[model samples]
Target: MNSKKILGSILLSLAACIWGGMFVVVKIIVEEIHPIQLVFLRYLVAIVFLILFSIIKKEKWHWNTKDFRLIVWIGIIGNAVSIVAQETGTWLSSAQTGSVITSATPTFMVIFAWLILKEKLTRVKIISVVMATIGVMMIVGIHLTGKHVLEGVLSLVGAAFTWALMSVLVKKVKTYSSLQITIMSTCVAIICLLPFSLNNTTALLKINFFEPKIIFCLLYLGAISTALAFVMWNQGLTMVEASSSGLFFLLQPVIGTLLGWLLLNEDISIGFILGTLLILGSVWVSVKFAD
Candidate 1:
């Protein structure tokens, strides 16, 4: 209710909106660029921004051995693997399908937290898992009537599982500022993309860097979505409970679904709305009693 919490909430909401909007952006960008290149560029721009901020803020550059290990693991899983999975998944599935399946991340996170971090799973968590599963099924089952739907469904499930792993990994690392973490993770992603980036030299060279859409995506992804949003998220979590933070994440699918419909002319079926409600209920129950 205070200004800090209010600002955090707004920033978190904005982050969710950006994430939601990203699927549509990816769909558009892939028309002109390979997914790996696009994902690489997204992080490249973001890494530059984070580096600039670290310099401006005089954040310490020195990192301990333990911190280095944590960043390396986080970078590999969270940045490299998660992006690849999500991009590949979206390519295999519709944005709506990908978004809906992604809503199950909290469910995966709960299980991971319990096993890895010794967090107790209460009755609330159990109910949440069920609701979230049903919601996911409603969306996937309704939309997945095509022959290739199984492939899409598998891709989405893979993406969800990878992202869930990243979320748990984030909670485990205690060292490094969020900015440092972002920078390190992005650098790792850039390294991971080197082979693909090198192979696509002709295409990369032909790309008009000044293109309006590319510029827009770069700015939004780097400054607004990646750097500032990440900082705001870490700050918000400091002021709020973990369960409350997880609740806000439920906004991702809702905002993404609506934004895709409006901006990209992506279809929104009855099942999409119903599925969103189911996921929302799951998130609510998870957050309410996971304390």
Candidate 2:
């Protein structure tokens, strides 16, 4: 494999790991703050860091009007819509259901990449996606019983589909630098989210921003998870096939499961071990055999 592809794989994997770790932090903070409020604050801080990073790197922000539409699609589908659907689905359904449903993202990504980008789906890629998906189902488990089963299932499925679409769309953006793409899409997402957040103004004001834990969580989510991770992911997407890069997302659940075991003292079952091994093997095979 070329160095760029290798680097892209590493960066994407690291981003996945960072995001997985954020789940633990998010679980803690969401207990005290509303998810919408947290999302608003998290992206607000993230955009600031992103802007500063762009300034430091001196990355050009210029883009044509046509590119603006691409950014808008990415912002809406990947950030605003996907997040809202995922959060709403998790609220209506169980986390296990949400995780299991969203784990279908790689499968969706492969299909979208094949259909939209005309990317070839080789046998190795297909096998890896299947193995990793089964691993994710094993790790996260699944239970669909709920009052809002249809709504939750549809929302979660939409989230996964839109997210996969966004990953594929990122490949079509050739005019903007990865950093520029991240910033524009993020700015657009924040704009899209603002109207929904306005009603929560009073609750937003009441948040204890001065609390050390809250401050830490905000910075971690904003800088490390959102800003840095998205940049890495976008850059990695540029360097590799979207379908191949999608396989790396499986690392998120593996890392999340391990973090749960270490931090929350969650019990690891035999299924967890088997799932982890399958996921790791899938990633290895996908990266090694990627065309």
Candidate 3:
């Protein structure tokens, strides 16, 4: 109802939309690049823009040695591990599968927020999360997948859980600005990813990364998705409660699914529309009544 919460909600929604579109881009680009190397390159681009933005905004680079481990762990979980898993899973599975499976992120976030952040799950919040969960399941349907999909499914599930934990941990942080956190954590992540990316980077040198389409996708991933969306998501966390914040993530599925259908020729059913309505309802409830 208040302006700050409204702003936070908008930022969070925008971040979700950006990330949803990221799947499409990743689906395209990951065909040409390995997932780990892609993540590494994405962060390489992100850190450059982040630092420049920080400099322009005159954001304090204030940091304490004690919190270095926290930042590093958060970086590893969210930036390095989750993103690598997500891209790999998407590569192995259909784009829709990637989006739909990871839509479970909000449910994981709710649980983590309760356990780690000790944010109370109000009746309203619980109902909203439940409704969104049901909606996601409905969209996915009964026949989940066979053993063939096990690897991708596990990777995506791990991504969701780790990402959720990182979100809650980020909410616990109050001293650093989002810009500061994003820059520092991203730097740490780039270092974390370096060793893994060597072989892939060697492979990368053989490909024409400068292809027009690939370049455009890389720019979008690095600048818009990673740099802009991350700052928005993190700053939004500062404005709202961690529990309510997760509800906004439900939007990612709708956005990702629709984009996947339009761009990737992915299928959609009546369930998608019906499920999306439930998700929207849940988001509205979260914004209006969540504790």
Candidate 4:
């Protein structure tokens, strides 16, 4: 209802849209690059861009030593662990399975915020979460069957929980600006990922970085999706309650579905239309009434 809350919602929605569009580009590039290599390259570029931005702005990087633990937890669980789980789950299962499972992130976020941050869980918020979650299931066309059903399902569930925890944890951080938080968390994540990524150095080296399309995809992933999106998300989280922030994440799937229909010529079924309306309605309910 307040200006800051409204702005936060809009910024988070924009970040979700960028991530939604990224699904299409990632699908294309993943075929040519290993997941680890791609993720490594993305964070590497993002960190560089963030450092330069920080330098240009002359932002102070100092923080209490006690806060370092929170930063590390965020980087490890939010970035490193969640990413590995999601990628491994997708490899073991189908992308549909990954999408459907990850859609539960908002619900987990609600629960985590309630338990960890002591955020209020009103009736309207509960109903909105249920509505948005059902909409996501319908939109993603939930399919549990995959090659390694148990492993994939567990991994995806882990990813969803970790991602939710990360979002909630962002609200707990009060010592750093959004840019500083983004930079520190990303640095920690990159360090945690280095061991795994090092093994794929040969694969990374094999790719032709000079190629225009490859360069474009990498920049999009690094600059827009990683660096910019993280900053926007942290800023939004700072402005709104974590539960309210969770509602905005549903936009990712809705946007991703629409993009698929438009770009990939994917079918737009009646279920998809109905689901989209339900999700939109949930967003309205959460934003207008939940608070």
lDDT of 4 at 271: 79
Candidate 2, residue 241: how far the Cα is off, in Å: 0.6
Q: Per-residue CA lDDT of candidate 1, range 25-116, in tens?
A: 77666667777777788787887788888999999867678767866776777677777777666766667776777766667767776777
- Structural similarity to truth (TM-score) of each candidate: 0.84, 0.92, 0.95, 0.92
The top-ranked prediction according to lDDT is 3
TM-score-wise, the better of 1 and 4 is 4
Per-residue lDDT tens digits for candidate 4, residues 110-201, read: 89999999989889889998998888878878666756778988988998899899999988888898899889999998998888888867
Q: In model 2, state the lDDT of residue 247.
A: 82
Order of all candidates by TM-score, from best down to worst?
Answer: 3, 4, 2, 1
Q: What's the residue-level lDDT of 121 in candidate 1?
A: 70
> lDDT for model 4, on a 0 to 1 scale?
0.81
CA lDDT of 251 in candidate 1? Answer: 63
- Backbone clashes in model 4, listed as residue pairs: none
Give the top-scoring candidate (TM-score).
3
Which model is ahead, 1 or 3, in terms of TM-score? 3
| C-alpha positional error of residue 120 in candidate 3 after TM-score superposition, expressed in Å | 0.9
- The deviation in Å at residue 37 for candidate 1 is 0.4
Query: Any idea how many clashes model 3 has?
Result: 0
lDDT of 3 by residue, 1-291 (tens): 889999999999899889989988998889888999989989998988999999899886565765667778889999999999999888878677887788778888888888988888788888998888778766655335655477888888888888888888888776788888888889888999999898555697876877898788888999999999999999898887887888787777778778888999877766988898898888888888864
Q: After superposition on all CA atoms, how large is the RMSD of candidate 4?
A: 2.0
